[model samples]
Target: MSKDTDNSNLTADNSANTTSSPSNDRSANNVAPNEVTFALAQSHFLVGDISANADKMRQLAIQARDQGADVIVFPELALLGYPPQDLLLRPSLSGRIKSALSALSDIQDIVMIVGYPHVDHHGTFNSAAILHNGHQKGFYHKQFLPNYGVFDERRYFDKGRNQVLFDYKGITIGLLICEDLWEKSPIADLKQQGVDIIVSLNASPFETGKQDMRKTMLTQRSREHKVPIVYVNAVGGQDDLVFDGGSIVAQADGSIAHEAPRFLDQLMLATLNVDSNTFNTQEKAPLTLSRESEMYQALVVGLRDYVNHSGFGGVLVGLSGGIDSALTLCIAVDALGADKVYAVMMPYEFTSKISLEDAQAQARRLNVSYTVCPIFDAVEGIRHTLAPLFNKSPADTTEENIQARARGVILMALSNKFGHLVITTGNKSELAVGYSTLYGDMAGGFDVLKDVYKSQVYNLASYRNRLEDTPVIPERVITRPPSAELRPDQKDQDSLPDYEVLDGILTLYIDEDMGYQAIVDKGFDADMVAKTIKMVDNSEYKRRQSPIGTKISQRAFGRERRYPLVNKWSINS
Candidate 1:
């Protein structure tokens, strides 16, 4: 049952309740003879797959019970998956949720807190169900529905106005959904009811420093409330979001007792001392990954899940011997393994000899299947066929574009024949200002570096080389001048500003959403800012047709930033 709305205390007296068996002594308070064993299952669930998710929950529950856990907790929306997005609107989902709940009742030994969607006469709600001894005890609806960037929970759920408290053996416990722990009201309300511990179910997505933020918040909450906390989070990639399963536990003193490894699925077990209001874990806290390592894992997990969930056989990368393609190839091999990755180097007449050598060296180093397909014949054939129609027009970007399109044709043909998904290699800087040829280098099912800037591309390559004992990308690929190699001595700087300057301008204008004048105020050249903004504005059509990619930054092209393709509101600095 829900608590009273008037802030009155809602307490259920379990002093005499002896329905469930106790694992430890119940009366001694000096030494915490009575302790609660909590199993935090940091699981990776498929979105909208109710049956599979329910089955996984059952398996995890049985495993926890076998380990002598008194209660177990799953992540937010574990049964229906997180951010079911508009899927909650479907009437059929209610039936599937019911079936899942019925299936979850089969585990009869331990108590489980499972997150899912709940419906009633009022409306739908993001809720958590409490199961004890194979029966539905009660449930708690999420109180705060986050509505800011990437979160639109208010559109689907009615805010829960009460706290849910349950009794496990001789100890009193409470539950909070993902966003509820972030606010002060929910925990304060639970404190009013005298909860011994707080168990949070989360589906928190990964940002650069999100794990640290979580730990800080949990520490503050525990110390402020003088109550320990056990947090369980969902792990895996869903679309553009990647949840870095870093489930944690904090004692009343605001000290971390255990933290699960990032980007992994784990079952965290801990013991809560009721008398001392502290908890401890046998497992050591996982070492925090470096910035590069964290971002790299995010890309790998995002690509792996997308490929596996989408039912693709493998990935094919267009290795151009440049930093962008070289980094993309390394990510592909790391994500799907070398055997599953195929590297193709399509060189034309203008392609440099050094580029050819670097491409071959990288392919051999990574142990991926390599192919050298010369596109000179294809480029000449197209030009020859169009010569009469054009009346012998002087060669321009059209010829350069033809070379790129020929390479695209080869990659797509290989994909069609072998069922391998093509991975595009264009970086964010080129994409920001329309430097990339649409349907040429952009022709792929996925763009691994669509959100990564050209400046970041070099850093990632160096990071990869340093991460491993041996370098997979050659030194020439990392040190050489960036080029399209579609025309002789064609350097990217000749067409656009230096990547360091261009990337800085794009981040301010695009990611920060600054005006042209505002960007100039940030110590940037006014002419360059205007030119870059103009290119970005004109390239909306190209971006609209670009493939989706993993979102590693605060602002990415596909879902994070949305701009109208035909808007005429240009800022005149």
Candidate 2:
């Protein structure tokens, strides 16, 4: 949260004089004489590439100037990328930032509000620099540093004590960063400063229903302040987080003037009328996406960026013909092309004939490189190796786990040999209750559905199938009962609760953070609630070893939810 600092008592370092002289200003600012054209640069910036990021800003600035823009806005920390984590602690961070800012100083005419880290003798600050006419006009340090789930801004940046506002082409624009807009004090203070408009830069990550919440907040803030707002967000995948660029523009009357598409890069423009304090309505605004579409695209962008940025030739998915791997294959083909994707059906003695047929059918439909690598030899070799130690004990889950491990070894071997990443297909339901093996089915560099629940996997499969004339995933894959095919006549429900009941309890306990009694009070059986909670608590070690995936829910298993591997506190207690 930001403090309510007096505008008159603002320090010298925070505010700057950005008004240009009549002789030096460009005609773009004088086009309407009373209006200002803003270019929102909603772009994907690669992390740790300060030099290339700065070059991109320079190029975008020139393009904005050519399109008759008075000012151009980049997302928060566009120079260094978002969630830079410990890279902010690098000794050369200050030097790199300084060099990048110097590189953009030559751009002319258009005002560039670029987000970068400002390292001074005082401390490092998440700041936006206003560059115009070969001079650093002024800079605004982000006042609110969010330190909640997935955000650790306070770990690296100092609190900004002063408010920053400046004038450009008859418009008094107040500057705020991502978290600043979410707070009440920043926008309220800007309103008190007679600011005509608010331009907020963001690196907001994607999650289900996040855009609607943002739009609601924007409408409320703009109406209250009687000021138009321009929002620009960064778009791309960085590790586990996906930034969906759904930049927005809201009029003073609380109506949406423009909205950029989600999960894509966009350079959007809008003109603000100084008299009415509203933007001119464009011919079209992008339609909002359905829940399934949003989640699916987030997965695609997350996987696409991770594989490509990590220098992998392509990706390999173990196609089990179950819904999990079936949905995974469709996503892989969409993210990377059919040529870059390869599917291997690792069938064992227990695997069904229907599974084998459907696996081959889907691969043919998608036109990807598919292989049927029977794991009979691999599993038998492992069993023979361990049989000497066992004194003719009864067969159990141990043997079943061997089948999964055999497949894991084969996939990792192919990945190591060909330099392609192995993408796991485990869903959140199995991951929640520790149903997956540690290094067996979980062996992979990335898990596309790691954050998605099993029920949602079916929804996404149906959504993907509906997009084409012919479904890429076979109908039998979705209709069949899910199984690991590690044991004979296996169905997931044999060991766990039905997905309907299981996801309900899991959503309450994990996502909602409800207690055991509270979840049981929601009509779930008491014993089932206790059992599910115990499994989730006991599986922290497995989740810790799990690969990163796209975050599509309110709370993902990674950084968003942290639990001790061995804790004495019980849900019942």
Candidate 3:
């Protein structure tokens, strides 16, 4: 759904045509239900890694059982990973998933609630299986399938209709999916019908302090509906998204009993005593990570999982010893260990020897593998190759691009031969103004700092290096004019405005979605704004091919950011 679409009224009546078996009720009465503890198991999963994911589920189930959990709750799409866009179209994979579900059901001694794609006569469904009493007792289809901003859920699954309550060990627990809890009607309707608790399975992506927002919303909902809520979310990275599995429980009186940390995967066992006693909450919410720390961890985990899950042995970066490449290398080293990172200094005619020296020094300080591969010969060869086409005319921007492309191609060849992934160092500000070349500087399997702006890139680089504290990036590298070193005397300021001014205009137009005239009204140069917008508008095709990056802003280039390639629309409108 778009940001504007709200469908809270999609609640369906689950009034019983037939009641629970009297024998079942008798069985429930005979069993003395004390403090019942259930485990919310968060798994780190890779997309389409079926057997590995099932093995993970089986292990979590066994561990939860050992920890005295009556039921183990997994996240949405735990079977195949979340947002399995085109993978759902494979019929054999769907069959394998169903077989895997059956295999999981065969495990004894624990009830498992697993999210997966279900194939039915009507179509495929985003569903969770209610496994108990030696059989699949019930199934719930996700109703509010999101279809916006990296979620194309509507493209695959069918919506559910009924809301049924399951009686397990004498507790009436209502089942809902991720987006279902976002809608108030389902939980409210269940509470009106006298449900005890809501068990929601989710794969919600991490976006800064989304956990705090979830806590606030669920706490208010618990107060609004007079029912406790247990939220279980998936943990890991899939392409651009990183799920911070912060499984939490909120009591009806607006108190949170248990809260898990963000980023790390865990199996949390929460015990809730439900009875005819007065409706009053007794537990306090656990202290979650502060907002700054939360965003920091999100970036760390995002880079970590992106490296590990993509099957890259290490990372190869063309380091210019500038703040951008320095920060990118620091993050890569931190994420994939210094031993796994291979840095190459690809200096051209404009490159200063200070850049090469500082980069080598910083690599030594970090204990990373460093190499120097000057591109002057390759530049001449490329100029030689294209000379016949250009009739040996004066070299232009095309020649500069040839140099960048030579570096990119060499990095990619290293990536191919050695199983290392090339990390692109261009930040969002450079990408926004078409300062980075396509198939040249932008050719990489992933971008570590693509969402960050240029000025913020310098700050983060400085923070990571800690010259005042420990020094990860060399001081000389930080103290230099920003340059791509494409020509004999080239600098970033020559092609674009100062980063301070450029980042400000891009923020207003890109993040806030402001129009051209509105940006001009903010006292920015009209000609600069027009030029920046034109560059941004022309770079749509390049952005489309760029690897997915973690979303740090309201509008990131990977998923939340969408644009038309063949368009003449100007922001003046």
Candidate 4:
């Protein structure tokens, strides 16, 4: 942590911003004593699109300059996009990145602080540089490399180790990348150098309640260093991760002067008073959302960015009139719009008339392109072929799985022919217990509801309906018991515990990492707990094969939580 200063030395105000006379020694650093306006570029960047990202940065830089901004700060890895993964290994993108950086120099007048992977003979570093009047002013490499949970910077980037401080106009400003601000040494370095403000560029991914944590951390950093901090974060989804842009500008007193909106791409402006070493942030209150609404927006933003960035014409969701598919469909429509979304109801023999009617009714309600592709013949054809092998035994889950496979095949065929991204609808509950048929309902380019549990699916569906003037999801779909409808009278509860109980047990077992007996100790039936754990344990192989989805929780199926698929350890034993 940086050294702290007494509050009595600071001027505090609740209005727009505050200003205070600098100390005698600090007054020497003020050259001209003029205020500098900084534009925080909380923009979206496509992963690995060097040219596009550069073009966007140039446009934003020009816009910032035209708006009379003295400086503009972009998020970390904004040029090549954040967490480029193995794409960084491509020798081809290096030249493009250098070219893009050169092109960015075309914009003059305003100072630009940009983040990118600085590659050279020394190897790649998570880095940021200050540019002024088409020349590099100062540069800093990130001091910390986060390796845990969704972050693997150690695999791709070498740790950065030096402090970058420069005199801009009259104020001495320092630069820090994402993880650098979270650590102590970097801020301490800047404090010792007597920098007035710290401008941090970040590509921090979103998790439940992550913004609150960021605010607390930024406050701590500001208070410790006795320096104001300008935090700029990227917005948009890159694969499973979504960056919720909540850029902030806070004073040494730990009070925010500006806070940008989350899940949105916009430029936020703040003016730093050179003499006072304080600035007025944008005067809008941060938008607050409930936990459910936050998770819902995460799913929507992740899906929308994934589809648009991938160049998909639209999305295709198999609407089975079940809660999982119903919720998936609603999210797709909301994300990509009804015009871009195509819904198909693949009904088989076991599919009830209510399902048939409800699917069509909901499609009509949402007014998306809806089609019915009966899979009875396709499932029968498969059943006939497998009849010889299964003739010795009574029909089991294999038969039920064939119907799901048939529906999956049809959805995929449409996806292939029409160029629509297929969206899988299975929830975390089904995915956890191996209830989903591999390559059947699991076949899709993306899974919107993959991180969402079954109980949350129902709640999100109800929440979606409330967001609309009229209900998009049929009431019966919400009220009716959930069923796969692959077999006659097939209810999910027939195989698994009621979702209320199943989800609770799962939260403890999977999320909380409780032992078998410990979960049972949480008031669940011992047998159910044992059985559920076994199902979850045995289904690792299936989850490993499932499509990647938006991660709304701290412990999602992919990336966040990793378990060996071939493990034999049993909690019950």
Q: Number of the top candidate by lDDT?
A: 2
lDDT of each: 0.84, 0.88, 0.77, 0.83
TM-score of 1: 0.92
lDDT for position 412 in model 3: 86
Pick the winner on lDDT between candidates 1 and 3. Answer: 1
Model 2 C-alpha lDDT per residue in residues 1-573, reported as the tens digit of each score: 122232211211254333333215564544676777899999999999999999999888899889888789999999999989889999999999998999888898778899999988879999998777677767999999998788899999998877777766556788999899999999999889778789999999999999999999999999988889999999999999999999999998889999999988888889988767779987988977999999999999999999999999999999988889989988998998999999999988888899999999999999999999999998898888889988788999999998888889999999999999999999999999999998899999999999999999999999999999999889988897888877778889999999989999999988999999888889999999999989899999999999999898989999899988777999857
Residue-by-residue lDDT tens digits, candidate 3, 1-573: 011111111111232221231111222112235545678897787788878888988898888777777678989988888878889998687688877877776565566888888887867888887664345656777878888776888888887776766665546678889888998888877776667788899999987658878988888988888788889988877777779888887878777777776788889878766554122232554456654455556666778888887777888988887888888888787777899999998888778887888888889978899999888898888777777889867868888899899898888888889998888988999888778888888988888778888887777766665434778888767777888877776788988899999999999988889889989999999999998989899988888877767776667887687888897787655
Model 1 spans with C-alpha error above 4 angstroms: 1-33, 281-283
Instruction: Supply the TM-score for candidate 2.
Output: 0.96
> Whose TM-score is higher: candidate 1's or candidate 2's?
2
Give per-residue CA lDDT, model 4, range 288-393, as digits (tens). 8877788899999999999998999999989887778788877887798999999999988888999889889988987899999998789889888888877668
lDDT of 4 at 173: 74
Instruction: Give each model's clash number.
Output: 0, 0, 1, 1
Model 2 clash number = 0
* Selected candidate, larger lDDT, 2 vs 3: 2
TM-score of each: 0.92, 0.96, 0.89, 0.92
Provide the clash count, candidate 4: 1
Q: For candidate 3, what is the TM-score?
A: 0.89
Q: Looking at candidate 3, what is the lDDT of residue 69?
A: 70
Q: Write the per-residue lDDT of candidate 1 for residues 179-225, one digit (tens) a residue.
A: 99999999998888878788899999887778889999999999999
